[model samples]
Every structure is written in C-alpha cells, then in structure tokens.
Target chain A: MTVIEKVSEHFRVMLGQKKEEHLGTITDLMIKRYALAIGDDNPLYSDREYARKRGYEDIIAPPNMVASIVDWSVGLKEEDLHEDGTPKTGGILPSNIQGIRVMGGGEMKKFINPIVAGTDVYVTTEVIDTHVKEGKKGPIAFLVIKNTFKDAKGKIYCISERTVIAR
Target chain B: MSNTQPLQVVYSEVEIGEELPILKKNTSPLQLFRYSAITWNTHRIHFDKEYALKEGYPNILVHSHLHGAFLTQLCTDWMGDRGELKSLEVNIKRFAIPGETLTCKGTVVEKKMVDGEGLVTIDLKEINEQAEVCAPGRAVIKLPLV
Candidate 1:
C-alpha cells in the first residue's frame, strides 16, 4: 500500500482509542513568559499578589495555554525521533498521516477552571473523525483530534479539537 | 501597575450599527515566535522555515487562536470594563503567516434590550496584508446601557 493508504488504514483503528498524555506541571515562569510574549499586560496573568487581590489564588495561565501543553506532551521522546532530528508524529496520529503538514484550526474551548502554577494535568486524545476531500493538489484528508484534560482526580477541565488536513 | 487605556467605553453609549475603532497591527517572525513561546506552541510551521516548506507552506503560519485573540481584543477594547462576552465563534478561511500585517475591525450589527439586559452583536473580521479575509467571526455580548 502507498504511504497515504497505510496511514488511512491505521487511522481507522485509532478512531476511538483513548490516548493518554501526562502533562507535568504548570509553571509560574512559563505563565509569565507567555503573557509577556503575547504582549498582554493583564495583572491577572502576571502578578501573583495582584492576582490574589482580583480573587485568584495566584497567577493564571492564559486561555490558550492548552495548545502548548498538547505539543509538548504528544510528540515522541527526543531519543526516539528520526535520524534527521526532525519531530515525528509517532503513532500519536494515524501512521498514514505521518508526514502531512497539519495546522491548528480554530477550537471551541471553554475554560472550566483556572490553571494555576504547579498543577499536574493529564490529557486524553481521541480521533473524532476522518474524511477525504478533493483538493487542488489532488486529494486531501481531514482528521479531527480531540483532547480532553483532567486533573489528577480525573475531573474534566477542558476539551479542544484540532482539524488537520493532509495533502 | 493597573493597565489602563486612554479611555473607558461603557456599553450604554454604543449604538447598533456603529463601528468601533479599528486597529491594524503588523506581525513579524519575532512577534510570532514570542506568541509561540507564550503559548508553548512548537508546531515548527510557525517558526521553522525548513519544516514549513516540508509541509507545503511557503513560510511560517500563524496560530488560528491568535487570530481569534486579536478579534477578542478588538471587542474587549470596545466594551471596556463593563461588558462581558457571551459567545465568540471564528471560522478560519485562510492562513496569515508572519511578515503579514493584519487589520482587525468590527461593527455593532444588532443591539436590543432583552428582558432588562442589553445585548449586542458584533461582526468581526481579520484581513491580511493581501486584503484577504483570513478569519471571519461573530460575538455576542451583554452590555449595560447607560
């Protein structure tokens, strides 16, 4: 089978598999750096004492913090990557889509609780669906990856889905 | 320090069909890198040209959420401190990469007094340097009419 065909068949098996990803912890420095990087000067995200005055226990990560956590937790370990040192998808996604370039489509995300520093989170990923459409280049495949985050106790925190296209 | 803008706008004075002050911000690779760092995004397409080319893109791509955040800022700046966003939905039509200046604009489309609460509909769009609508979105907000 061609590379694309092989990837497609592997995706079929991943349709409902529950993929586990352990995100270590949320750090204050990372949160501060992120807020600074975005040029957001909101005291709620950068100032701990100020944040407490505003009713938060401490500095909170921005709303899109989940995006970064996914990238870090999903990629293969550095030692297991390709010889070229390029990041590989591993079986995190379908094998057929091992090489397609995927972009972050917008997500419908809800912030259930504030993500404070030193919180260990776990994410469960699932392939929600896959479809093929004819594109200008030829045929393109669209895969939806849904990731659900939960605290150590298994209480759900947030859910996000990314739509990726493979050409 | 309290991050205060020059002026605060209350939702009461905003009229239906009115246009908010538009902002045109220029973006670059450095800015995108800072954003990626802040978001902890290492997609490679946002920073690595070689990786992007391998993925069929001519250059680095911007995160879809960044586009939405820009629009959200536009609305929040317009609402100032008194209004709260109820819902926001953005549909990505095209990609806006680094080195492209994007203009974010919005219009107050509908306004009504619903059961003692003031509601507003704002139509928002982000246009790239090429004048293409990269992300078209809408927001519903609850405002207090002065």
Candidate 2:
C-alpha cells in the first residue's frame, strides 16, 4: 500500500477511541479579543454590563467559539510517529495522493446555554467517520472529527465536528 | 425578545446582486494568543514557530476556528441586530496566520421569501493581502421586512 493508503487505514482503526483533552478556562479578555478579531463589538461578548443588562449573568462567548478551545493535539503526538513517518492512531492522516488539499467546512450546533468566564472546559474527541472520494485532481480523504466540550462539572457546552479534505 | 437596530436593512431594499461592504481584519499574535488563552487551545502549531516549521509552516499558523469566527463576524454585522442568522457554514481553504490582513467580504447570491421570512443566501469570502482566498463561506440569514 502507498503512504496515503497506510495513513487512511490507520485512521479507520482509530474510530470510537476516546481522546481526552483539557481546555482551559473562558475569560472576558479572551472573549473580547475574539469578538474584536471577528470585528464583533456585541455587548454580549464584550461588555459585562451589557451582558448583564441583556439578562446573561455574565459575558458570554459566541457560538463556534468552542473551536478556538478544542485541543487539536489530542490524538497524535509527534513522538508517536513511527520510523516510517506515519501517524500510528489518529484521524489526521497524510494524503499520499498529491495536489488535493482539505479545507475545513461544517456547521456547528451550539448549546442554548452560553459558556461564561471562569469555567474550565474539557474535550473528548473521537473519529466520527472517514470516506474516500474521487475528486477533480485525484482521490481525496474526507475526515470528520467530533469534539465534545464540557465544563469541569461535566456540563456539556457544545459539540464541534470539523470536516477536512486531504488530497 | 428581539432587539431593534438603528441600521436596519429591509429585505425589500436588498437586491440579489448587491455587494456587501467589505470589512478588513488584521490578524496579530496578541489576537491569536488571546484567542488561545480563552479557548484554551495550546496547539504548538498556533504559537510555537519551531514546532510549526517542523510541521512545514513558515511561521506559527492561525487557528482554523479563528477563520470561522472572522467570517461569522462579517455576516452577523451585515445582518445587523434585527437580522437573525439562522444558519452559517464556513469552509476554510487556507490558513489566516499572524501579520496578515484578511479582507472579509460577501455578496447576496440568492433571495426568496420562505415562510414569510426573507431568506438570503450570501457568498462569503476571506482574502489575504496577497490576494489568496483563505476562507470561503456561505450563510443563510433571515431579515425583517421594513
């Protein structure tokens, strides 16, 4: 099998494995900067007073903000690579195929409850699925990773599934 | 529980071909760090230059979620407080690294009345200073009739 094929095969076996990760706290400064980075000056995300006035007890983070907190390194550590230079047990596999790039595109379903500052979060990610497709250039790998964010109390905040293509 | 806005855009006034004003956003390390601090993302690729270079990046690359947030801001701002963002999907084609100016712009691609609501489909794009398309997106919004 080719390198890409080996990587794809490895990812196939990684499905259903719980990868534990700890995401730090939510802070007002972080929320405000993220809002600013996106050019959103919404009081709900920035001003604590505005948020309290809006009935939120405190400042709230935006939807899709969980992506900013997910531990991308949960699965494969660089040291885990074998001498063959292939990831052993992660969904992020190298596309042995050439000229195809995977872009991240997906809809995020957010919880009605907002994530407030001072809350510690933990994420447990798993390989949801993988499919091979024939693309314009060549065969592509469409990989999906589902990450669940929870507070220290194990309260679910949001679930984020990122889809990427590797050609 | 709806909030009214001063800059309300009526569905009737917006045309299918109208181009939304583009807002330029510059990505900085501080912004990325702050984002990381809040999100608790400690991916070396986002801040560690050597690690990123080992991964074959020229410098620390921006977080993928940040790209989505950038697009979300553009769409929400255009929709205004009165407008409701029913659905939004962002597909990232390239990375938005630090020290790069990403221009977020959009165009109304389709408009129709669905269930007494003005549903607008917009073609969203984020381009870097080098004119490369970093993140391309699409959004479905519900606008009130003025």
Candidate 3:
C-alpha cells in the first residue's frame, strides 16, 4: 500500500482513542523562557508582583504555552531517535511512519482559565478524526487531535484542537 | 526591567472595525533554535537547513506555533490588563523561513455584551515579507464593562 494510505489506515483505527499523561508542574522559569523565546515582553509571564496586581495568583503562563510544549517526559536515548531527530514514541503517530515528514497545519484553542506557575499540569490527547487529501505533489494525510490541559483537580486550563499534516 | 504596566482597554470604548497595533517579528536561525530547545521540539526542519532543503523547503522553517504566538502577543498586548483572551484559532497556509519578516495584525470584527461582560472578536492574520498570507486566525476576548 502507498504511504499515505498506510498512515491514514493507521490513524483511522486510532480515532476516538485517548491517552492521559502527567505533564509535570508549570514552573516560573519555563513560563519566562517561553515568553522570552517569542520575544513577548508581557510582565504577566515574568514579574510575580506585576501578575498579582492583575489578579493572577502568581506569574501566569502564556495562553498557548501548554499546547506548544512538544514533550513533557524525559527524552529518549539519542540512538533511539528517528533519523529526523524526532522521538519514535510519545507522539500521535506510530513509529513506522517516522520516514514521512509531518507538519503542523493549524490549531484552534479555547482558554478556560489561567495556568499558574505552581499548578501541576496534565494533558489528555484524543484522536478525533483523520483523512487524506490530494496535494500538488501527492496525497497527504491529515490527523486531527484534541488536547485538553487541566490541573490535578481536573480544573481545565485550556482545550486545543490541532491539525497535523503528514506527507 | 521593562515597563510592567498593561494597556487598560475599557469594553465600552472598543469599536467594531478598529485595527490593532501591529506586532512585527523577524526570525533568525538562533531564535528558531532557542524556541525549539525551550519547547522540547526535536524536529529537524526547524533547525537544520540541510534537512529542511531535503524536505523541499527553502530553509529552516518557523514553528507553526510561533505564528500563533505572535498573533497572541498582538492581541494580548493590545487588550492589556483589562481583558482576557477567551479563544484563538490559527491556520498555517504557507511556510515561513528565517530572516523573513512576519507582521501580525488584527481587525475588530464584532462586539457583544454577554452576561454582563463584553466580548470582542478580532480577525487576525500574519503576512510574510512577500506579502503572502502565512497564517489567518481569529481571537475572542472578554473585557470589563465601562
């Protein structure tokens, strides 16, 4: 079977499958580094006093911070990584599809609450849908995944739906 | 230290069709590398130009999430302390490489008073140096009523 067909078939079976993970605690340094990396000067992500003045309990994470983090666990050994440098596991796709190139197509996010610095974050990822589309070069596969971030108490921080393209 | 004060946007003062202050970004290879490291993204296309070319891109590509970050900053900076972002959606239409200038802009589209809170919808977009639309997005924010 062709690669696109193979990937799509695999993703189709994963539809509705969900996996929950402990993403660890949100730290002040993580928040600050992310904001600085994006060149965002918002004091809400840095200064504790400034954030407190704005009603947040402490420094708040950027709205998209949790969703942008690619991995939360300790990384794989270098030899186990894909040729492309991506991890073989911990991703939505199976290891067999490592040869294919994957790209982020887009995302839709709903911010429910501010994620505070000391909050322990957890994520639940579910494969909502999958399909194949014809591109100028060839057929491409699209995987639609939804990620819900919440605290230990199950207080949702945000919900994000992302489209991943495989070619 | 940079100024910690945020712009106080009053709900009653926001007008439909108003334009947001533009936020411009120019990505360099070092910046992309740092972003990748911070996000724990091991994808080579974002940092290795050789690997990126093998994949048919002109150079190392910018993270799609970075585009969203720029747009988020555009909205948050404009809304400041008086408002909170409720939702944001962005679709990547094209690839953006390093050294290209990406401009993020938004236009206020609709406004409503829901449950004693003012909600505003803004259409957002990020354009590349070639004037091509790299990403188109939308954002909804809640503001305190005047």
Higher-scoring candidate on TM-score, 1 or 3: 3
Give the TM-score of each candidate: 0.76, 0.71, 0.96
Question: DockQ for the candidate 3 complex?
Answer: 0.74
> For residues B1-146, what per-residue lDDT tens digits would candidate 3 score against the true structure?
25646558878999999999888999999989989998898888999999888887899999999999999999999887778899999999999998999999999999998888899999999999888999999999998887
What lDDT tens digits, residue by residue, belong to model 2 across residues B30-137?
777766655555456667677667766777777677777877777767776567666556777777678888898899999999988898888988899989998788
lDDT per model vs. reference: 0.69, 0.69, 0.90
For the predicted complex of model 1, DockQ is 0.37
Name the lDDT value of residue B51 in candidate 2: 67
RMSD of 3: 1.5
lDDT tens digits, residue span B91-137, model 1: 68898877788889899999888888788889999998778999888
Worst 10 residues of 2 chain A by lDDT: A82-91
Worst ten-residue run, lDDT, model 1 chain A? A91-100
For every candidate, how close is chain A to the native chain A in TM-score?
A: 0.80, 0.78, 0.95
Q: State in Å the error of residue B52, model 2.
A: 3.0
Tell me the deviation in Å of residue A126 in model 2: 6.7
Q: How should the candidates be ordered by lDDT, best one leading?
A: 3, 2, 1
Clashes of each: 3, 1, 0
